[model samples]
Target: MSANASANSFQALVRLLRYARGYRRRIVAATTCSVINKIFDIAPEILIGVAIDVVVNQEHSFVARIGFTTPQEQIVVLAVLTFFIWAGESIFEYLYKILWRNLAQRLQADMRLDTYEHAQRLDMAYFESKSSGQLVATMNDDVNQLERFLDGGANSLIQVGVTVVAVGAVFFVISPLIALLAFTPIPLIIWGAFFFQRKAGPLYADVREKVGDLASRLSNNLSGIATIKSFTSEAREAERLRSVSEAYVEANRRAIQVSSAFIPVIRMAILAGFLATFTVGGMLALRGDLNVGAYGVLVFLTQRLLWPLTGLAEVIDLFERAMASTRRILDLLAVPVTVKDNEGKPLAEPVRGEVSFDAVSFRYAASGVGVESVSLHVPAGNTLALVGATGSGKSTLMKLLLRFYDPQAGRVCIDGQPIGEVSLASLRQAIGLVSQDVYLFEGSIRDNIAYGRPEASEAEVIEAARTAEAWEFIQALPQGLDTAVGERGVRLSGGQRQRLSLARALLKDPPILVLDEATSAVDNETEAAIQRSLAKIGHGRTVIMIAHRLSTIVHADEIVVIDGGRVAEQGTHAGLLEKGGRYAAQWRVQTGAMEESEALG
Candidate 1:
């Protein structure tokens, strides 16, 4: 790896460690167990050397020097020590495996939850710019990648380190000349692992990106299945899916090619080290310069030390893959939150829904299409309607009031208090919104209605449904309010879903209600029913309506015509028609079209 890339990888590891600081005690315990187990694991090789000395050297053996005089006694003592070593290895192996695997499970779960919650609080603009599938990939696939490494790769690396250090110490003490020749190839193997890492890192990163693109294509196709079928484009969609899947496969193939070449090169390097120790130690023992038993220990320990280095290629592959995923997850957590909720006081109690837009201006960064300097106000209990052509910024005004996007140039106030100065939870709780693009959760009719107030009594849910003129249709279903809504309410008609959305907002019973083309999806009869209900319910609460249907807002206490993000006109319905401006021109066109349809009928 380049020095810079290596530094960044180290930084990522450090950041990850800091993130998992809560599990430090468990990490320490697991690591200690792994080291101790590896020490015991290498003891059997040394025992074989001691057993040979007992059989060949008899009273002159190393064990005899330790006070076991007879060859049979030395052999018996060696057997007992070997048994205890193997048992210790087994016990600590179990302890480390369980500890590492449990830590992996817990850390992954906590990281996913924290990342999801942070994503939820980000501003609407952030979501608009990102795809849902990419977010899902990070939360699920990327997090699982880190978990897999922790499950086994971490233990393998720890043991490899302990093996090299413990075996190298024994080699140098027995015969420094053999140890020097045997360890000569160690630097070359270490360099090769890093060389493969530098080459494979970018390839693995490409593999991860392809996975996200494949996920995005699948998510979009599944959500729009009805459209594809209606157009009879199933074959085309299938081909598109195949293309993305193939790209993912190609990316993985490239990464595998690079990682696969590392092991063969590493195996050759390991052979050089083992041969050096075997030939040199044998020559020394023949010359009587090295003890025979010590020469035997060197031969066995050489293989034990060098063979594990061959597995380094696999361990490095896992490490690089996991570090790629870790960087993605951490990048998501670092996204700046533009709409911060930390610096505001709670909105005052008994929020009287007096709302004002004071010379407000907000333009979307991507499209530069938004409201200009617009100003208006609604009294605490009055009804105000907004009328505009498509893309004229009528909805933008409402978004500003909700603080979905703060105005770039001016202030939005509710109950005479600047909304940006109030806590987001209190500000949003004070207003209820029922938008034209209605969404229903996959659950019962009663659950959707009571979503805004889950603890509401059954009687209250029924009443809210009745007020929205939805109770009759709900009752016609076999399960009444208990009937399932399926995904995004696919089981219900468009009109039925719209009413349920309204019912949900009504149940919240906020002091202010905003309806953005709320009745646009319903039939004429249902629209009339909802209109009548609105008349009854609009008595005391403030209502802000955005409508393309001019007839729906004729009875509003005041009507404002928005043109190019500015207020073109404002007055009561009768007064605006008398003025004969933009509002009058649109009213004439809509009413004339209705009259001609009536005459034809």
Candidate 2:
């Protein structure tokens, strides 16, 4: 891994640990259990030394020095203490396992939920630059990595620390000279860990990026399966996916190559420590300076201390991978939310639904994309149609009204109150939107229609469906309202999906409605049927419709012609046509083409 990436990853882990402050109590309890468990676990080695002393030295053993007085009574006392030591080790093991695992589960759930909620709160501009698959990877795969670490890494780290502290104290007390030799290799092992971490961090981050790319490809392909099949590009897409999958595998292999070298180097260091302790302690025993039993205890404790250091490779590998994911997840959490809730007074229940755009101007960060200074107003219970060529700021106006992205200049108002001064949720709640690009989740038709108002009754859903002219086809389905719509409602026709969206908006029954090219995708016959439904639905509601087909909205109360983000013309449809301006020219061109197509047919 590069130095810059390693530093970034380290910072990410610090942030993640900070976020985990809420789990401090659980972490402390788990760490305490792990330490206590290791302490008791090392007691058996001490017991072995005591047993050796009892057998080899009779009444003059270390037990007698501690005032036991008799070999037989000392043996009985040692046996009882050994039993309790083993039992205590087992008890703490259970406690650590339960605490750590539960902590992992709770932390994973909280991180996933919080990430998703934050993602939803982010502005549309953020989403435009990121893929759905990348977001999903952060919420699911990244979080699962952290959970895996917490599940085992927590206990392993604590135990490693406990082993060092507990065993180092004993070695120092028993024989400081030998302890120096045994502790010499520990610094080298720690150095190896940092080196491995530096090399592996970037590789793991690359692996995460590759996985997100692979997921993005799969998600895009699956969503566009119909297009792929129609174009007969299955082989092409399969090859593309194979390339992405192979990239992911190569990324992981790079990380594995670096991580795989860590254990061997660590083992070499451990072996040096073990052999040093063994030879020095044995020499001390022979010189009568340290008892044979003490030498036995040194051998056992040395193995207990050094062997677990080999497992450090596995724990460090988990830590590095988790920290990589932690960085991505935390970075997402750190993305500054440009749009926030307004601390303004709430709109009264009986809002008039009047909307106004005062000199609004917006330019996307990318080139050749923007809406210039624009102004317009639609009174309550009136319908306004926005007509223009593609890229004429027609749709951008709707986005501004919905507060998806606030205009860089000028103000938007709802019911005479500046939208900037109205709480976002309350302002949005007063408006219902149905866009040209309809999206429906995999669920029954009834459920999709009632998405905004889940508590709405089945009768209310059916009524909305009827008003949207969707009830006839819905009832004709095999299971009526209960029929499952495949993923993204792939099972339904495009027109059917749009109707369902309309039904959803109708169910919401907001005071203001914005339909941005809502009927553009449907055929003329279906469009006429939808228009008939809209006529009745728009009565006494503030409706703003954006349409490329002028014929569908000719009856609208007012028509505003938008060109290059400016209001070129504004009046009733008939009045605009009489003025022979931009609106009249667009209408003539569209109607003339329709007549030509009809003649040709």
Candidate 3:
């Protein structure tokens, strides 16, 4: 390998070893078993020579020198030794397999979980810029690839090293000349492995990238399956997916083509060592210069030592694939968490519900759309509504309050303390958010409702559901609260999902509630019921509501009208209507649309 490539490999290995640190004891034990197994595994060749010596030398065999006097007794002694050797080999083989496989499973699981947790702690911008499918591929597919190598490749490599040492030591004890000849191919094989690794490193890295891209394509297509069907573009999507798959296949093909040439070339090198040992050792026996049994041992040991090197090519193949995957997995874990809680500050206690935006401003680094130089306040236990057109600052203001993104300018304060100075958990715990885009996991209805507060009692959960006006429909289902919501709550209608989300927030029951178009999906009647529920429980809590449907916020205690990222108007709903400005124009258009529809009907 080139120095640069070697350095990269070493760095990757060090990082991986850090993950394996906790399993060090098991690793040592497993490694000891592997070495012991390979030692005995190579002893069978030496045993073959012993059997031959017992036949040729009879009472004068090496066993006689050790203790036995009769050939029959020596043969019996050899049998017992052989039995133990094979038994030891078999026992350690079982141990290493169990140890290595279990290690792979545990390590992979831990790596996946850490990567996912770190990903969650990253800022919103990172996720917005990256592909979800690629992230999923890293957490699932790439980690699995690394696990596959740890399953067998790791053991094979250790055994190969043991074979070289054990067999070479035996050969040198008999004849240094034969040992030199038998070991001639070792350097070539080692060089071939390094050569293949350096060449295959980037190829497999590209292969990993290609596979991740393919996964991204598939994820996107599946997520947009509804849109694809509505547009009748299945063939187009199929073509795009096929193109992505072809890129992956071609990348793998390049890696395979290079790796496939490895074993055969190394096999030829192995054959040269085997031939030299067979011819030279046979000649030594003919001249009576070496014992026949010794010659036999040399011949057998030579092949055992060098032929396994051919499989080294396969081991290197697995190692390279694993290293590629390891880098990706490590890269994910290495992502800096820019959105974490301030370590210098602790979460606030006894939150009062008052909120303020003191000249707050924020602009998305990527999208360039955010609230700008805006200021507002809602007193403790008062409802405030923010109304604006799309691309205005309504949602951006809420995001700042939630700390999903920190503002570029100004401070958002809750009950006099700047939120940025409070612990993120404390700030989030103080507020409940029910957004327009409701998401429910693949679980029963009760599970999604109690998501925010999993330890809530069944009665408390039911009461929250009733508060969101979702209890009636949930009861109509055959399983009631236990009914499955399906993927992203696709089993329920939009309004039903929104109500469940409201129930989730209601269950949280924080001091402050932010409802951003939370009732958009529900009909007027259900919306009214939810508003009534909100009105009842919302009395004691500060409410920050964002709605494009201005009617929902008409009853809010204070209404702030935003236009072009600035506050255009602020008053009670009646006061804004009396001003006859933008708010009046929006109210006229919406109410007129409703009236015309009713008249036509």
The best candidate by TM-score is 2
Q: Candidate 2 residues 1-601, lDDT tens each?
A: 3677668767987798799999899989999998999999999998898799898998899899888889998999999999999999999999999999999999999999999999988999999999999998989999999999999986897799889889999989888988899989999988888888888888898998998998899999998998999999999999999999999999999999999999999999999999999998998898899988888888899888888988788888898889999988988998988877775666666888898999999988865566888888899999999988889899998998888898999999888888877788888879999999999998899889999999999999999999999999998999999999988888999899999999999999999999999989988767987898899888899999999999988999899888887888899988998999988888889999999999999
Ranking by TM-score: 2, 1, 3
Query: How much is 294 displaced in model 1, in angstroms?
Result: 2.2
Candidate 2 displacement at residue 533 in angstroms: 0.8
TM-score of 1: 0.97
Instruction: Please write out the lDDT profile of model 1 over residues 297-341, one tens digit for every residue.
Output: 988998889889888888978887888788889989999888767
Residue 279 lDDT in candidate 3? 95
What is candidate 2's local distance difference test score?
0.90
**lDDT tens digits, residue span 573-597, model 3:** 8999999999989999999998999
Model 1 alpha-carbon drift over 4 Å, by segment: 1-5
Compute the lDDT of residue 527 as modeled in candidate 1. Answer: 81
Sliding window of 10 residues with minimal summed lDDT for model 3: 1-10
